[model samples]
Target chain A: MEIPVPRPSEPAKVFHHSCFAMNTRFSLVLVGLEAEQARALAQTAERHLLACERLMSRFDAVSPVSDLNRRAADEKVTPPDALWEILTLCQGYWRQTRGAFDITLWPLTRCWREHLQRAEEPTDETIQRTLLQTGFHRLYLDEAARTVRFQSKGMSIDLGGFGKGYALESVAVQLRAAGVERAFLSFGESSITVLGSHPHGPAWPVGVGNLFSPQDAVHTFQLRDASLSTSGTAPFNAAGGPRAFGQIIDPRSGRPIEGYRTMSVASPGGMEAEVLSTALLITPAEQRAELLSDFSAVSGVEIVYDSNAGEFVPRIEWKYGS
Target chain B: MDLDSPSLSSSGLESRADRREFLKRLAVLAGSSALIAELPWWSPLRVAPVAEAAADRVRLGLVGVGTRGNLHISHLLNTPGVEIAALCDDYDPHLQAGLARVKGAKGFSDFRRMLEMPDLDGVLIATPLHQHARMCLDAFSADKHVFCEKSLAYTIEECQAIADAHRGSKRVFQIGHQRMFSPAFLQALELVRNGAIGQITQIRAYWHRNGNWRNPVPDPSLERRLNWRLYREYSCGLMTELASHHMQVANWFLGAHPVACTGYGSINYWKDGREVYDNVNLIYRYANGTHAIYDSLISNKFYGMEVQVMGPKGTIEAEAGRLYAETPPPAPGIVQLINSLEHGFFDTVPIGGPSWVPDLKRDAKGTAITHEKSTDDGTAISLAAFANAIRLGVPIEGMMEQACRSGVSVLMGQAAMEQQREIAWPEGFRI
Candidate 1:
């Protein structure tokens, strides 16, 4: 391979801003724009972020998703077009992840949380009953009518993981259209998207920091015009004791994925990275290759905490692509 | 620290449960038995309620039967084995109003005369700023226990004098920083001590209220007496009247008083010829280089009040009673249990090199510090603590120090703002 000559970098000052939305913080670092212009761009992006929050947040009593959650179990509820498209995309990812990444497992999660808080585990009968309220397969999306209906009486959906990626993707689009070619956006530092390249390099070097020592980056990824999503699980805990299931429930078994592990994925789009990260975490190692083969130009890694050192030391156990 | 949401109704901690139940809840709020032992005020709550008898009762006299004084009257009235023996206020209407609320309690226009009342075990001083030192000193001289309302005194010299008077006395002396007894604040303190939020990085506290901080004056002649908090002569304005509560909390959580302070304040919005600032901003520097930033404004009520204890790992909004983790990692120790149950399959095996496995994030609201909505803001329990301490005839071990630290800290801030220069903690101040 021939080495190419590098282009000279701009003497740019980064303008930074952060706003809370989608239950996490969204931060922006804009290069080469004047302070005022960058502030305006950040404000515009924040507006877009909040708009996405209004569409997707289940906790909001009047959000479109909340409205659907209330009415869909009884009738075919026509969501706004934007929300419908989000649901449609969720359905696509649900199928692609082989029923692994589900938005309808909220009931099972609630069940486990309730049991954990009481220092008990759910009985088999209770798990089976709660499972009836879960599963993406139980949802019926009318493509023509732009409506959604639940096959069961208590099915609900949460876009907690997906909303960050989708909002970042939308905001990135807005920023690009507004002539922001070199920028970075992050949601809680777990979901990140970069535009063009680093101010001084060909690619932005983003890192997955050590969980215990967050300031120490354990893994670095060279990214350009890409999105990275890192997700992890230990257990569903309240006040640090009586742990029960993981925060991320396994849609198939109606149980949580076991152990302290984080899955990181880099993809060409924010939504893809977000979807694949959760999907890949739930998919078994024997099946991950099949899952990854479905997507192009994507990479991922799974990190497990090693505690034999008397402290948590993150070690990479599984990785695919580059 | 699993201070779980109680199934109790929101009528507030009025259900007088058993000692074991209270201790269990206190343990959860304070983290451990060792931690609970450090809080001397909590010991009083654990003591069994005394039988209702005049001989065994804690007879307390009240000074300044105004706004806060009336609140104290309510809490003290309900406190176990406590009798409001006397009430005093220079103002005639307040004296009459307070006298009407308590049966068999004598009324007096002078606090000095009230201090001479027979069988008055202690005196509760809710008087204006300038009177705290003299009232506390006179009450101490009368051999009475003292529970003085906060911003301990009008000036640093007075705070030192009050602390010096009460230092080694057998009589109980308590400062009315009620958050000391608040379940929500106790839970936050426990979490911070347990390193749930890692090292203390910074604390930012703010209090915002929409209306002008003023009271309707029945007569123009009594304006300064009624709204004493609005004048620099009587109070340090927002710094002493308002900021002291949060500043006390900051000092308690940080385990140190500020070594120096600087601030800026002005009568920005409400220019009603008030001698004090309508808005104040201050920064207090502790010995460890941690700075506590405090601000108060009466022009906006968007964020009513919050004492945000921030660190590298998380942030605890004490007033809102929520904890927000920085990265919110899942319970890592649970991994050991889960992996061990799996017979070390994935735990030991080297999965074929570099394949995909991933996870993501959840945006759940911050965890609640306490389930109970304490409508009294711990004032009731704090009053109970005062009564119990008097009954025990022992000074609260650290009460005088807490009073002096917060009292002097706010005075430093007030001086810093007024002089437009940094003010160091009062040198040679005794506690």
Candidate 2:
């Protein structure tokens, strides 16, 4: 219900545009440029984002990711150079996060979602069987050949959690290369990146909010030349019930983490911020600091919903940096 | 205006209520048959009185029992106070097939013999383009009403001759631009006339298909006769067959024929010794400085077909049955604040939102204009009108003009493409 209010008269230097792509809204706002020039650059950025969706979407039967899921179990398949690079980056993050971040958990996610839809929890045997098809250890990549192979059948990789961040980073690269000095990019409003300082401020002030009431900010972060990502309980559970369940699943337990909690992480790299946000959400609170030690110049915040009262209240549970 | 509840003021409410009342009365008038004759003589909604007796049945003969002819037969069969008296096709298989569908209908190989049936009240000329002019002239000479399937004739002069002959005669002449009777199109036209989308600036239309656009011929010697659409001598191919429907809509909506046109065409994909271009692109400039851009191809069906009538405020996609506003309405307080700020006024802007939500919902596709279900593209309704007009012996207003304008416009497009220059509207062609 945010009304489009008239702007105060100021220098007519900012250009903004939004387009739907990758199952989310991707927006770009650039400062200190003519409207036509900014629009041309935004068009280029949108094309890049659309291309990423074409390559990464698992729902599209003809996408490369779908082809990999269908064929990689029996033979090594060489991917396009860009996809190969992304796979390499994912592998590095999987190892760095100590298996906290995983793309091969689609089988477990599907099992839970289907059982939840049936109004039943997955049987223990079903969970164990699906777990066998997951785990980054079973996925092998040949560096020289730029090929990928999955050791187990029924294994699939879903980039839904990470594709947005990657696309934002890719667009940022394109915009910066085109001599765009100051710009803001947001993906689904959950992940945001800034190219330079704000026009009238030192940094772009972005607020981390209660997931249920997004308009009320619980905390604000000064984002400058960095990206911020948030991971939390979905607005509804898998069966579309209001009683929320966390979307972040613990890889070791093979079950969705039980809580109404959210984690926000800021890092210099878009991919790093996205991975660490989800990784930190499922990690033990005491061990969260140790997880952050592996990355540099990163800040983290964890907010847990206190439901003792009649209404849910978001309270900051932990903070890693000022 | 309160930001929380942004309802219209008293004066605004009064004006809106008055407008709604006016539109409601207009809709009632349009739906009532009693007021149809009082409508403008050129209005498509004008209706003739219905037949009241069994002897008032209009006996009709159909020429060219091809694809279009069969569709017309199906509709005519269901129409009240109508009889299919004769079916004619030079091709024995089509003639026999058409005769089989309509019981007790006499079959003839020559359309002239069918025209000689003195009892026939009308002749439905569904023949190929090259045969339309001759068949229509013959039917008119025999003093029979004519409902010729579209792209009126094969040549400009033939279209003029058909119109000229029908002008002095008491025959009820109608074209096959069924969209003229389409409920959706009528609703779209109503919206346009009411200034729902503002002054018309441009129209863009396209029709696409992925096929060879051919009919299976049992024998090679019947190639030209069977696949008549693929030969230049028989038809104008995609221009007459497909683009004409959209061109008729363009002319009808703009209320004027195009002043001039230029275009390019080529047989790029289906080059199987076909004489017509498989692809065509054309631009028609109107006298009002607006232009209609049109294109058609048989090699790609991705976009399918659509006729988008666009203005500054919004676009009415008549084919898709949707209207998309250029900009969604902003909140009232936001509008007021913007206006104040533009005028350099210091105002307390009342704006608030729940934190961390997406700022706006993206709507890439427009909303549907109406929810009423209609399975008509105007063919059924057009035939009913034709039958009613014939029975009442009343000529349909604007029917001949619609036929001439669209028939001449598409032929001009073909000429522009063939002669490699802009073709003006046919001179001295009165409709």
Q: Which candidate is the best by TM-score?
A: 2
lDDT of 2 by residue, A1-322 (tens): 2223344457436666766677656667677788899989988988888899899988778999999999999999998888888888898999888899987889988887777777677888888888999988999999878789999999999887688889888888888888987877777667878888655456655667665565466777777898888886463263344455666777788988666887888888889889998898888888888878888889888888777645668898888875
Q: Which candidate tops DockQ?
A: 2
Q: Give the distance in Å from residue B133's predicted Cα in candidate 1 to where it truly belongs.
A: 0.7
The per-prediction tally of clashing pairs is 7, 7
**Candidate 2: residue B240 Cα off by (Å):** 3.6
Candidate 1 residue pairs in backbone clash: A231-B359, A231-B360, A263-B358, A281-B358, A319-B354, A319-B355, A320-B354
Indicate the worst ten consecutive residues by lDDT in candidate 1 chain A: A1-10
* Per-candidate interface DockQ score: 0.04, 0.05
- lDDT string for model 1 (B1-431, tens) is 00011222322444434322443454354444356765767776666567778778888898988877877776666666889999998899988999999999999988889888887899988888889999999999999999899879988888878877877789999998888888788778888999988999999999998987777889999888888888888888888888898999999999899999999999989998899999999999999999999999999999988999999888999998888766434222222212322231212111111112123235343777776455557776777777777887767777887888898999999899999999998777767
How much does each candidate deviate at the interface, measured as C-alpha RMSD after superposition?
Answer: 16.0, 8.6
- What's the residue-level lDDT of B202 in candidate 1? 98
**Which residue pairs does candidate 2 place in steric collision?**
A6-B338, A214-B354, A214-B355, A214-B356, A215-B354, A215-B355, A216-B355
